[model samples]
Structure formats: C-alpha cells, structure tokens
Target: MIFMNMIFVDREKELQTLMQRLNSPTFELVIVYGRRRIGKTSLILRAISGRNDSVYYYATERNNLERFREVAQRKFPEVRYAREDWESLLHFLRDKVVIIDEFPYLIEEDKSILSTFQRIVDENRDSRTKLILLGSSISVMEDVLSYRSPLYGRRTASLKVGELKFRDLRHLGFSVEEAVKIYGFAGGVPMYLTRVTPPFLDWVNRELKRVDSFLRDEVDFLLRYEFREIGTYKEILRAISMGKNTLAEIRDYVKVGGEISSYIKKLERIELVTREVPVTESVRSKMGRYVIRDNFTNFWFRFVYPNLSLIEEGTYEITEGEYANYLGHVFERICREYVRDRYRVKKVGRQWWKDVEIDVMGLGNVKVAGECKWSEDVNPHSVLANLERKVERLGHTVDRYVVFARSFSTKEKMEKAELVDINDLNSWFMS
Candidate 1:
C-alpha cells in the first residue's frame, strides 16, 4: 500500500519494439522471462499503459487450473463462452491481447497445457491475437519455451529482462556515489529500489535491522524455488563469497572429492553464478573461475548472511560497527563493477593477461584500462605505476589508462593520466 514514484529507467527500446509487434498484422506471441524482481511485470505494464486495446492480464498461482480459469474469466468478460477447461479457454479468446504472468506455474499445474497452447496457436494462426507469457523462474521458462520444448517454434518473439544498467540511474536522480551504493545493495532490482529511502545511511541502518527482510530471505527463496539441488548451490555460493574463484578451489570447498562439473552446470543454468575464463584464445584450459552474477547477492553472501545471528538478535550497533570497517572495500568493488559495466555497454570486451588483472579493462578497437579507488585522496602515481606494470606484463601498449576515484588527484597528477571524478561518472557512462 506504499505509494512511491514509478522510477522507470531504460528499456525504452524494448517497449517500443513490443508495441510495434502488437500493432503488426501477424498474430504475435511473445515470451518474457527473467530472474525474480528484475521487473518483467513492470516492463509489460509500462508498455500497455494508456492503451485502449482489449487486454487481459492474469497472474497464475499454485492453485488448480479451475481456479485460474475462473480468474481469467473474470478478467475477460467479452467472450460469452466460459469454461473450466484449458483448451476451451484458449479457443474462446480471439482477436484480443492476453498476458499471463508466472506462466510456468500454470504449465506446471497442468503438464498438457503447452500442447494445448500449441494446438490453439496453430488453429488460430490467421486470427489477430497478441499473447504474452511471462515468468520469473529462469529454469522453468527456458525449458518450457525454449527451442527444444514442445512450444518451441510457436513464439514470435522472446525477451529476457535484466537489471537496470548503472547508466540508467541518472534518470532516477541518483548521484554516482549514491547509485554505486544502491546498486551494491539492490543489484538494480526495481522493487528493492522502492524500499530504499534518501540519506543512504538511514536505509543501510534499517536494512541491517530486519532479519526477515527481502535481502535476508531472497537467497533462500530463489534457491528453493528455482534450483533442485539447494545444498550444492549453497555450497558453491559460499565458496564464491569467501573468495574461492578457481574451479579447483570451489570443488575442494564443496568436498565432492571429484570434479564438480554437474554442480557448476546447475548453477549456470539458474543464472545465479557464472564461470569466467581468461579472455584468451585458449578456451579448453581449466583456468576459468566462478563468480556470482548479481551484485546484491554477492554482497549479501559476503557480509550480511555471515552475520545473521547478530541481525536477528537486534544487534544493529554491532552490525553497523563491523560494516563500517569493511564498507570502504565494498564500495571500491562496486566502483570497479560500475566501470566494467560501462566498458561492456560501450563494446569494450578486452581483459588483462592471466598474470596481470586490471580492476577494469575495456577492449575494443582501442583498449582502456582503469583503476577504481574509493578513498578520499587518490594517488595518481600508484595508479600509473600499476598501469605501467600491467602494460609491461601484457607486452602491448594500451590506448587509454583511466583512473576512477571519489576525488581526483592533485593538479599536477590530473595532467599526467586520464582521471574520471566521481561526479562525472554518469556522463562517462552515458558516453
């Protein structure tokens, strides 16, 4: 019941594309899926805002198909024929727009629903119907609507929603520092952003106090709902959070004694984590490492989850004290992620050599390497020295060496190297 401003950012192009498809003559069937809280529903709602077309938006639950059909009937009253059966319901809807959220739940409740949908879509291929199925469970959505599934070739288009980019925060009225703090805590989830208030410290304090908060419970909920092997997933996340990057370290930490390839595959399927090999020509080498894909999950696993007992006991003071000690390092990491995201969006995909890893490296026609510092004062000499060492190790000259910091270096140092101040990060990212 909380009323907050709808801070919609980015996704403008996606919305326009969906609208264009909806207006086309062909019968459009789109599948939208993503991890929970990534704003699939929000994006769809925003696209349909102020539209006068016949639209029926139904959210599926764990109940039986009869109940779902009843709800669907309530939403779409134009069709005189109402039925509790799935095939009948699909057959009745024609020349209208239908959106079913959490589509996987409906498929799971009735296994034959996919085949029924395929038949209906085939029979009505000439009719003007725009149907969209949305789901938050990554695995279920992929398996059900993927090219290998029964409903494979039926979909006209598919979109996988993801987190808002750091560059989008400028539209939400957040300074670079504030955006970094929020992104580190919320991982660009729109729902999580609504829970955060101004005066960032206040939000942090409140978040640290709630034991049953979304931040505390999301990991378990996602694992239980999306993954079958919860124990293996937890072990892998714990290993990564504790700074175990290499596959060997993670396998040893899991203590499976043998290669944990199955567990790695499981984690990757759910998109909760990723395996990063050195950006090199050798793809078969076992030199890759695993890392958590989401920033908030990484922060939660590394800091908040480890101190659950303190959080539950209402020891806010103690938690805050400890957080203060490690906050600098956390912010430094966030800055690095921001710079890397900018590099990625700009089509810079280069990486440092295996022996020398820069905090952030942008590779395109021109190479850009960066060092992120979250200190009050940035020592330009130290950054330049590191860049020199990195260049020497790579045995190639980089096109640009940039330094990102809270505050710029002294006047003389600014003239020596490329410096991006914290305040200018938004512009830098947008560029």
Candidate 2:
C-alpha cells in the first residue's frame, strides 16, 4: 500500500469535504463511490488516516457472513459475543468510525444485510458511530442508494469521485501539450495517469507489445465488472467511439435485436458513456447524441481494438495517417472539460442545429461559444467567420467568441475572436 502522504494530489476539496464530515457532531453514513481506478479507496483511507477510533473493513465474496463476523470480532474483541446480530455488533461499535470497503460484495452474499444495516443505523442514529460505505462498482453502489433499496435515504453524505481535471493533471509534471496528449489516451484517472510517463506514445507502444499489459485488458475488465453481457456493451461502446453518435446509428451498426436504452443507461450511470443534447435543447430532446465519455476507452476502440492483430504481432508499425484529425475532437473535449472546471459554468456542452455544429458552448453570466482548430496554421478569419455564422444560425446572441488553435498565421484575422494556442492552456483552466 502507498503511504497516505503519497496518495493524495490536488484533492484538497475532496479531502476537506471528508474531513468536515469526520469532525461532524452527528453520526455520518457517507457513501463514496466511483468507477474503478478513480481513487475512491485512496480518498477514504487518506481521509481517515491517523484516526485512532476508526476501523477499516474490506468485504469479499468468500462466505461473507463468516468473514464479516470474524473481522468485526477481531477489530473489537470486547464484543465478540454480540456478533450474532448487526444491531448489537453496531452497538458495540458505537462512537467509532467504520469503513466498509467494496461493500457490494457483502450485499451480494446476503442482501438481507441492507435492511439489517438500515435498522442498525436507525436504532443508533443518535449515537456517535460514523459509517462510511465505499465501493468502486458504480452500478451496484447506485442501486444501493436507489429509492427501492432499504437504505435509500439513510446516507448523510454521498460523494462521486471523478477523474482529475486539467489543473489537477499538472501535479503529474506534464506540460500543456504533453498534458493534452496524455489526457487523450490515459485520461484523468490517477492509476492510468501514473502508468503513462513522458513520451506518451513510446510508453503506449511498449505496453501494447506485452500480452499481459493492463492497458490491453482494462476495457474488458471494466465491462465485465458491471454487466453480464460484455459483448453487447463492447459493441455499443465501439460503435460510439467510431462516431455512431445517435441511437439509430448505434443500433444499425451493432444490429442488436433488443432495446439498448437500459444498457445505455447502465453505461451512463457508470460514467463510461454520456448522452449529449445541445445546450439550448430540453432534457427530453430527441436530437441527443451518445458519446464514449472516457478518453482511454475511446482511444482503445479507435486505435487498439481495431489493430489487435498488429499489436499481437508486435510490429509497432501502426500508421499515423488517420490520427491527426482524431486528436482534434479529443482536444475539443479537453477544452470543454477545462472550461467547465475552471469557469464553473452553469452549462458547458456542444451546440448544434441541423448540419451546423459548434465545438463548445458555455452559458453563464456571459455566453461563450468556441471553435477549435487542430491545425498548424489556422485561418483565424475564416474560423471566426464560420463560428459567427453558426452563432447567428443558432439565432442566439453570444457575448464572447473564443477560438483554440495550434498556431495562427496573422494577428489581423483574430479581431473577431480570442485566439488560444494549444501550448498556453493554463489560463483557460484557471479560476
């Protein structure tokens, strides 16, 4: 295990939130959940570090009741006799902070534990026991917190740990250009980020040659963890990654017989896929497009999955002819996420009407619409003119126009929009 001191990076807000709850006068039932490798365990461990009155229990599948009883008894030998029931066990654990890690495993073994836990929390509501339920499986954790579950509203606090933002990525000693390229493949997941060193493509090339590499199997692991039908989910995500954005497009491509709405919802709940509607469109808009939200997964389907034969042969001769234009979309996504994180906008998403699509639109006190150009020498005037026409096409007044590009030819062309180079990205991600 990594030392607690070395575990956290740019997680001040999350740490503060957890600490505040830790110091609360009332009992806390905090639920911390997220996708795998997103650092949910690290956050919990770091939050409760150095607390003498804390017990961290990891739940596993092998005869969970016996394991739970043994672990609880070992942790509190004073109450070994009370292990027959949860209420008494919790009574003995009063005034202590308890962490149940990978909690879904226990639930799967015996689901009646939910109601038992519910009863324990209710009976000991006025006590000083602090309970934290931590899980990495997003779907199972969500179901545990759903309205139909016995512990629906029992949680005092819930936190969904997300990937690191652009600012947070800087802590890994990556430059602006390096960060963008790295994020396109490794994403903001800390585990993925740590595995990727500088010269990102070189590392990926090396990893791809190895049959046992985690990079090659991450997608499969993630899918198999949540869904029983891995082939269908893979087909759905593969289609989305290849630019089949709409439901009709994905369905036609995959040729799945049944309705895929539930599968899409499952993916959405886990943060792997997202359904995006125009910023101005209502939530029920039929013009929504499904997108593969994870950068690593997107990269896998676009490059790795299709060329598995080449990878297996260890040729390392994959062509870059088709890669340039792909990064443009990824760069646009990185820009949108950066703006949303730094500006704290009410809404940040793509805007479209008929055939016209604006790369990013941020709505707040001042409406901001942006056009991204992944080119060596961008024609600023033409880009701005096109963006202006799209803004007009939307028939909505935009107060600010921003353009992101690799480089610009002349300053005269940028009179209409603010030109942001790919290297100078810190200002865009700053508060």
TM-scores for the candidates: 0.88, 0.91
lDDT of 1 by residue, 1-431 (tens): 22123335667777887788788888988988888877788778877777655454555556645665665567676443756665576667776677788887787777887888888788778988888888888888888776778889888999988877656655556676776677666766677766777556677668778766776677887887686567777878889978898877888888975677777787788787777655443456576677787777777787667777877786743344454444454554555555555545343322555578766565566566667676657877787788768767877666777776777556354543577776666666555
Candidate 2 — which residues are off by over 4 angstroms? 1-7, 84-88, 316-322, 337-345, 426-431
Question: Candidate 2 on 205-251: residue-level lDDT in tens?
Answer: 78888988786778998887687779988989999998999888998
Output the TM-score of candidate 1. 0.88
The local distance difference test score of each candidate is: 0.70, 0.81
Error in Å for residue 400 of model 1 = 1.8
lDDT assessment of candidate 2:
0.81
